[model samples]
Target chain A: MWRPLAEAARELIDLCVMSDVDEDEVRAARADVEAAVARLRKVRRTQTLGQQHLTGGRRRPWGNPVIGLRNPIAPPLQVSTDPSGRAATEFHCGPAYEGPPGLVHGGVVSLLLDQLLGHAVGAAGRPGMTGTLTIVYRQGTPLGDLRAEAWIDREDGIKTWAKARMIGPDGVTAEAEGVFILPRAIRERSPSSPTGHIG
Target chain B: MWRPLAEAARELIDLCVMSDVDEDEVRAARADVEAAVARLRKVRRTQTLGQQHLTGGRRRPWGNPVIGLRNPIAPPLQVSTDPSGRAATEFHCGPAYEGPPGLVHGGVVSLLLDQLLGHAVGAAGRPGMTGTLTIVYRQGTPLGDLRAEAWIDREDGIKTWAKARMIGPDGVTAEAEGVFILPRAIRERSPSSPTGHIG
Candidate 1:
């Protein structure tokens, strides 16, 4: 589906080229098609029973594996769930994650935050998935040896909030707040217990 | 693999069925395995093959798509070559990109900036992909109406700097600064052309 659109945008450029359109005019048309392509590229097919693709982005209209990816350079963190919420992990970034020649890409910071925050949520008691996560990138993260710290911030009846920070050798590179949810069924499965009243 | 981890975590939930382990001890141990499971899940086998699964929170490794994009949700911005250094058109984001239920997802904001900045490089008489993009989400972004403005900020031969701002009905939801980089070959491809002056 996106291929034709890509071709159409390309054709529009060809059209502009044929019209002896000045550079400015050609660009105007080109930008229009390009913008549309960008918009269309993001739409996913509806989640029908027969659909092989998932609900959203992974169901990229064109099925282009590369574009379907979120960040192309982030590495997943590995940690041991030491029978308590504590764990340690490390990962390295390759040139693929580089920005400014050697600096780490900022999007990668947010990526790490989600992973760590999810860990924090799981540690807190209610573990499922992130409903929302936000980040503040304070400084440029060096491409190598980045470190992340995460801890449970608070827990509500069914939702748990966590905070996480990513640090590079220079200093803190990013901070995040995340909301991790425990589906209702998971909560119901628990027997009556005299612990922190989840309610 | 992830399923077993989830099941194990669920089984270890300090259920009342296990009276042997002290309540406090069971709780602590359950916390431990859940945390480990969370980290382990980040390494999706699909993702290792370069398939994207998450959006807004984590970005994939570099050379992958923008972060948190488990699937396609936005359209692509098409681009055409130009000697005068200008873009094809403007890109827009609308209701389809809602985050926070009604606001735009932070990752969606970053994705738009990435696309616009990538286009800006071409408009600046250079062609490249986004090496790094940093988006500062100022406030919650309204879902219905939004506009994105991007243009080349500076060009240092193969490296082009671009800036993008996301405008909401009330004000700016976010702004981004990016580095767009042309591969060495692409920068050297048209050294003989009129725009070669940039090289």
Candidate 2:
């Protein structure tokens, strides 16, 4: 039920962005959307924050903008990890994520890599906050299916470094490197663990 | 009309992420969302892509995820520019953008900086594509009112560099440096112009 609703919401956004129907039709659609919103608000939310786990035992990121299955804003990328702790996912971008004409937004590319690198670091049993992320765009990522992957580069003291890249239909379009650091608080608490939980 | 609709959509997403009401209520909400989608689809959209302008003469980014007034996924950031081409905005992030409990998602931070840097470069009359962006997270950005700013650092031939930072209630939460480049195609098209256009 959530999946369908999310998909529907995505389609609505696409329509909102691209639609050029008459103003009357737009008004009608707005009315429908408002009504739907009113109905959804009839219930109260629990307000408890969601939990984030390391990739080794990651849960569904229901509200995540990159991979959350229940988030309409998400491309909802499905990530798969190998035994070696490398992470990868394949997903498609639509007009809703456009920056340049018919191309994926650079921020969207960064968002995908950030999450992928975080997962890769966690899968390797070292979870930490994102200290720094550096991304390079080699070419424009077209709005369509693409493949992305990330892996651990090295670990130095409290920092775990990871690398990632995105491959568009034509070729490699973007690459990224991220530094994940175990906060002082987390390090003190765990003592023995290389790192704590990641975001 | 678009603003209210976008706000309503944002509220709905927050509900979807945080709600823990009865299953019957969830089902009912889903039905309403589905109905809204069905009504929205009654009209076909004009397939023309939207135009993006340089920040020097920027238009409202109605579909942009960072500052688009009509985009629900956007924080709807309202950026103001100084005569020197510095860009700044004050906005709020709600629970819909949470990552680590009460904190703003790291990816969301990247997204905001990416757009801010792009605008800064464009406002400098040297707009280019995001070639590279390096971000350092100094602390967690809490999900609430915050301020972000960006400015041009330097320009070299085909590249324009910019710097930006996000300030939470406590202090600086994150900072970034971006390298924007004028692609060969764009450069060739507007030979005399220092840079053609930006995304």
lDDT of each: 0.44, 0.76
Flag clash pairs in model 2: none
What tens-digit string does per-residue lDDT give for candidate 1 at B1-199? 2222222222221111112333344344334333332333332232221213123233232222222111111232333334444333334443333323344445556655655565556556565545555666566666554566677778786777777777887887777777655666555667543221111
Q: Model 1 segments beyond 4 Å from truth?
A: A1-76, A82-87, A191-199, B1-199
Quote each prediction's TM-score. Answer: 0.38, 0.89
What residue runs in model 2 are displaced by over 4 Å at the alpha carbon? A46-48, A51-60, A183-197, B46-48, B51-60, B183-197
lDDT of 1 by residue, A1-199 (tens): 2222222222221122123324443334334333332333243333221123333323221221111111111132453333234334566654334433345545545555555665555555566545555566566666667678777777787777777777888877777776666756457776332121011
What is the Cα-based TM-score of model 2?
0.89
Measured by DockQ, the strongest candidate is: 2
DockQ of 1: 0.03
- In terms of TM-score, the best-performing candidate is 2
By lDDT, who's the top model here? 2
Q: Please provide, for model 2 over B1-199, each residue's C-alpha lDDT reduced to its tens digit, 9 standing for 90 to 100.
A: 6666667677666666765556666676667666656666676544414344333244445777777767777877899876465999999997767766568889889988998998888777777789999999999999889999999998889888999999999999999999998666656765444342356
